[model samples]
Structures are given as C-alpha cells and as structure tokens.
Target: MKKVLAAVLAGAMLTASMAGCSGTASSSSSSKAASDSKADSTAATSTASAEDEALTCTLNVWGPAEDQAKDKGNWLPTTCEQFKKLHPKWNITFKYSACSEGDAGKTVTQDPSAAGDVYFFANDQINTLISANALSELGGSTVDEIKSSCSKEIIDSVTVKDSVYGVPFTTNTWFMYYNKSKFSDTDVKSLDAMLKKGKVAFPISNSWYLPAFFIANGCTMYGDKGTDESAGIQFGGDKGTEVTKYLATLVANPNFKNDADGSGLAGLRDGSISAYFSGSWDAAAVKEALGSNFGAVSLPTVNIGGSEKQLKSFSGSKAIGVNPNTKNPQVAVALAKYLGGADAQRSHYKLRSIVPCNTEVLKDTDIQKDAMVTAQNETFEKTSIIQPFVASMKDFWTPTENFGKALISKEITKDNAASKVEALTKAYKNPVS
Candidate 1:
C-alpha cells in the first residue's frame, strides 16, 4: 500500500518505483483445473480459421502510465509488440490509453463497450466489474496458465462465482519497514517489542491499515475464505472488543504514533521514528531515509490480552482482464493472457520493480535475491488475508474509518472498548443509506 535480511542495497534501487494497483488475485481448484483443461483445448481450435485468414484488427489496451513509459523501454507497448510477433497471423495495430489498474473497473463500468478491449485492473474490483458486466470470463490456456502460475488465494481474488476472470501479475499488500540499528532481529518479529524499544508509527486512523489488529485477533469478513457474502462480517463480539482494547493501549504508549499526512515517512527521514508500516509504494522513501540501517519484514505479532496474535494485512493483486464486448474476442483474450503471463510479469519486474506474483517468476535467481521481494512474497502467502471484494464490502470502509478516528481522538478507551466495538459492529451490519 507497505522484508527480509539487512537489504544493504536500498529497496528503491532494487524495485525502482511503486505503481498504485494494490490487491492480489485467486479461485477454486478442482473446478478451475477442469475448466482450464477444457479451455486449453477450445483456445487451440477455435481460432484455427482466423490464424489462416491472418486476422487484422486495431486493439485498444490500457494500463498504468509507468508501463507505457517510452523511457523505460515501454513495457506496455513492448509487450504488445512481442504479442504481435507471437501471433503473426494477427495483424494488430495497438492503441494505448493511460489507466491505472485501481481505476480500471470504475472507469470501465461507466462505459464498458467504450473501454479498452484489454486492460489491467485490481482484483478487488472483480465484483464491481462483474456487476457492471464489464469483465469477460477468461478461458483456454490463459485460464490454465493462471491456474498453474498463481497461488490459490491469488486465483480466488479474481474469481467471482467460481469463474476466474483476470490474470495476476503481482501481489498487493503491506509489511513492516524498520531501521535495523534500532531493533534486534527478534524485536522485528513483535510489534510490542519494537514499540517498547523505539519510536514506532502505524496507520491506526486509516480503515485499510486498522484491520490488521482485528484480523490478528480472529475477526473475519465474508467468512474464512472471504467468498461467502451471506456470512456477512464477523468483526464483532468479544474478539472485536479485545482488539479495540489493545489499540487503546497501543495509541497511549509513549513510543507509538499514528501515521497520517505523510508523517510516517517524515519521521523516518528525520530519525524521529525507528519503524513504520507500509507497502512497496514507500520503499524508496524508507530506503533513502534509513540507508544502511534499512530493514524489512512481514507483519509482526502483537501481544493482545496476554496472548500473542499474528497481525495479518489485507492482500490482493493487480491483473489483466478482457472485455467481452471486444469484437475480436480471440485476439483480445490472447493479448490479455500474454500481458499478464509469466513472461510479461518478468519484464514488468525488470522495467518497473513491479514484483511478480507468478510462482515461477518468484523463483528467479535475481527475484529471489531481492529482500523486499522475499518479505512481500512471504506476507502475501503467510501474514495476510484476502480483502473481500463483494458488493457488501462497500458498507465496510466508512464505519471502520469512524472507529479508527475515534481511537486516535481518544473517544475509544479501554474502559469503554466493549461498548465502542458493539457500536462499530452495528454500524457494519446497518450502514446508513
């Protein structure tokens, strides 16, 4: 939004820059495997006549400005060129548009038919895109490749009603960044430990960042796998109150500070804070601030009510999707698959420091060596939960944000943590229209 080793080299130098497409992708296995096999066959034979005819078409594609950069070898255009070479039968004229993955779904929903035939989007927008009938149900080797390349959770994130629609490129989540000189290796594993020893900043007032506490203490949204809308949100009762009480104590601690208005990075720069939480987006600033003292890790455990709970960040992916409205469905699907497959992800990493979510690419010698990649991959697989993207999720943010604001304002206290949590739970279920 947010490590391993000393990472003596600045992560900024390693990764380069952060793009805004935050969130990961995923789907169910047995059904997906069967679907993949069937689709693989159809993909091969369905376009046979088109291949012979040498179909020519003008294709519109959309992605982040970073990928379209001419200076960086034009990842988007270069990849498109490569796709053209592979499908020599298809004479493709590329038309490009600058659209961030995070904004893809909303923008496309406004006018799906007018949107690019192929585009990159955040996985959390799956539901919204589906509701608007803006996302196409992907099939063939593209579906097979996605199944083979990504983790189950990654696959599930892009799935709506058991069908996968997007091809994932990289993980989207947050982790801890610390000054190595201030905290020991063991200390980095525990949030309370870091807080006790050095100045620590956390985004306690932000809804997106606040859920780490509740998630650690057993709160869940849309059930365990985050796919069941009927399950509703489970962020209530004794478990929710426990987290509220913990946060109250955390905010009252002298060594703790709430990150807001860029104070986290400023604190790191001025040497006022020893550690903070964020995603790959802040790597450069953190690296420049701490230099040789830079360190990173997955979310740490927190001691809550005499018990240690592992804090889990919300994780998702940025992926490439196809529009069913495309007149040239065959070419559009092929191009979409090519852009998000392992090869494209590798190129994306080289060009933009966009970490790859493809399992095969993650094992590359160079990729494996990057400490930031190691930390991010670990957090994506271990200390993270998928952010539910169902329509019901719209009711989540404001109420959670209100709770966070109250915590920072001291309106929420250990003395009334239970009552406050009860109120938040009610708000979650009965969000005002």
Candidate 2:
C-alpha cells in the first residue's frame, strides 16, 4: 500500500519539464514535494517491503474507450503496467472495460457492488457517488500528493465537506471558439460586441449551457460555491429577470442562432456562423472548419442591463475514483491515484490531447503552448463556476431546459420575463427530484 505512496513521491521527484510523449514509465515529477535523502531512502525501503509482501489480486478498471484503444496508445493498460512495476509484490490482473467518465456515476450506482474496482467519473458526480457509498475517501501521502499537485479549484471539484474522494485528471468545461478572420482579438472579448459584427451560435437551449447568462448577472444555483442545497437557486428577483430580458433580446437578434443538434459546428464549417461556444472535444472540428482562421479563448463578457458582466461556464473535472465496495480496497485506491497522477495525465495529454488539470503538468512548455489547454485553464481560473453535485441539483436540469426552450420559442418576452423568471425560480425551489 505504501509502495503506491512511494511511487507517487518518486513521480513527484521527476522534472516537471518532462512533457514528451513517453508512456507512464516516464511519469513526470512535481517540484512541490521536498526532495531530500531521507525521503528517497524511505521510498526505497517501502518498495523493498512492498516486494516482500507480494500481494496478488484481480481488479477491474474502467475508463473511456479512447483510453483502451490501441490506436490511442492504450493509456489504461500501459499505465496499469507501470503501476504494477512499482508494487512488484502485487500480482494484479486488471480486467478492462469501456465506461466513459460521463456515465460512470449512473453505471456504478446501478450496481455498485459489481462495478469496476477503479473507475473514471466527471467530478460533478462526486456527491451522487458519495450518496450511494460508491466513492472511497483518499488519505495519507496520496492525499498530500494530490493537494500538492493540483490547483485549489481542481481539488475542490472532488472534495465533499473537507475530504477528497477522487483524484482529478483533467478539467471539464466549455469556452469560446471564433473565426479569427471575422473578429479581432479585442472584438472577441465581448459576446455583445462580437454579435454586432458577425453571426454567433450558442446552445441557448442546453441546460448545461444556459446558466452562464444567469450567473453573469448575480444569479446563483445551490449556493455561492454551488454546494449549498438549502440556498436553492437565486435565479429570481431583479437580477434574474434582468438577465431573462437580455436573453430574450439576444435570441431575437438577426445575427444570433440557437445551436442545436451540432448545428453550431455545422454553421461554423460553412461560414454561416463566425463564432461558437464549445470545449476541447470540438477542437479538431473547429480547427478543420476554420483552418488558419481558428481562434479559441475563455468566455467573453456579456452586457446585461446597463453594465458588462463576465460570462461564466459551468466548470469541473473528470477524475479517477475507487469503489468503496472493492474487495481490494488498498490496491484500488492506489490505482485510482496512479491513474490521475501527473505522469499519467501528461501521457493522456500526449496520446489523447486531454487537457490536464495537474498543476505541474500544466507548467511544461509544450503543454503551456497548446491553445485549447490555455483556453480551458483560463476558464477554470477566471470565467467558470463549480457545477453543483448535490442530490437536490437533479431537480435543476429539466426546469432549466424548459426555461431555455421557452426562450428559444419566444414564449418569454420582455413583457413576460418577470413572471416567467419567478415561475422558474419556484420550480427550482420546489424541484420534482
């Protein structure tokens, strides 16, 4: 068990500048950890003891299909082999499966006892996993390494109360992508400014994408940090109605189009829309669409009422987590930490272009130069809020979606914005879930 801890420390000792396409064997080290003779000696002794223990177990690990694909570098099995080498005592047989991070919480909770011993999940699912007793809390040197290797915001994504339940590997959020030929750098800074000069497409009807407007104008969900359920949704009152009116006017603009069914990307491809909002998952498509004119940036400010307010996206992380029900609790926990460790993240980035959340990995010159990484990190730090994961949040989606659909259909005009916003607020407070 401590052998995993030693491996983490050793990985932290490797130069943070190692940003190459090496597999898990070439895991990068963090400068944040103390590098001393005593620590190195202890690490060696721990490895020796772990070899003596010689534990053998069979465990199941789960992640997205891309990670398991040989064409994609087989990130899962490759990293697993590296972990096994660190704990030579553990004769681990890993059973691989394709369960994307987005579906991990639902799939696991459906039959947690039978789910993978180690798995990947979107950080917003932390509360749900905890509620089902599916996620195990991390502690000791593993917890210490995690804290030292990630940003506070990244750490907060997997934290419940004061305990961390998962190790985040990459950020999850959307930002702005525009056509450089259509908008100047200055013009791209403001959504309202950009709209006047070029066609803009937004997924206004998406429940996930709808809150950016409300949040920009003093509205809140759950609570300030998005963890307080009793605080309910503060999307009513003057501020909320003001945003509602602004959105109504926005949707009615001749240059604006509601992005639906990949219509935004489609429009970008045909030059029908010069700007769109999305995440790294669309980077290739956007790049292919715009060629040399491609541009990506953190979300821009939106004018609401009489003032300019910064538009924010819902932000979180995709993380590696261990099932609390795993028979091999120690090994499962170790593997979870190893998979999300800095080295694994660097490899994931090199092999799959997954934007890493590990602070040390983010410092590498190559990783620093990636346009999509910059956009995502900037949004995480400056233009996004944690998406709440409390059980009560389940009630938020449908109502918000219905509200956005109404806006798209022009059912809520400036005249009816107040009443409609109030009704939406009520629905949030008295959610069906």
So what's the TM-score on candidate 2?
Answer: 0.86
Q: What is the C-alpha lDDT of each candidate?
A: 0.78, 0.81
Q: Write the per-residue lDDT of candidate 2 for residues 213-233, one digit (tens) a residue.
A: 999998988778777677888
lDDT of 2 at 84: 87
In model 1, state the lDDT of residue 316: 95
User: For model 1, how does the per-residue alpha-carbon lDDT over 46-77 read when each residue is reduced to its tens digit?
Assistant: 45543554555688998888788888669999
Clash pairs, model 2 backbone: 11-29, 12-30
TM-score for predicted model 1 compared with the true structure: 0.85
Q: Provide the lDDT at 207 for model 1.
A: 85
Which ranges of candidate 2 are over 4 A from the true structure? 1-46, 430-433
Candidate maximizing lDDT: 2
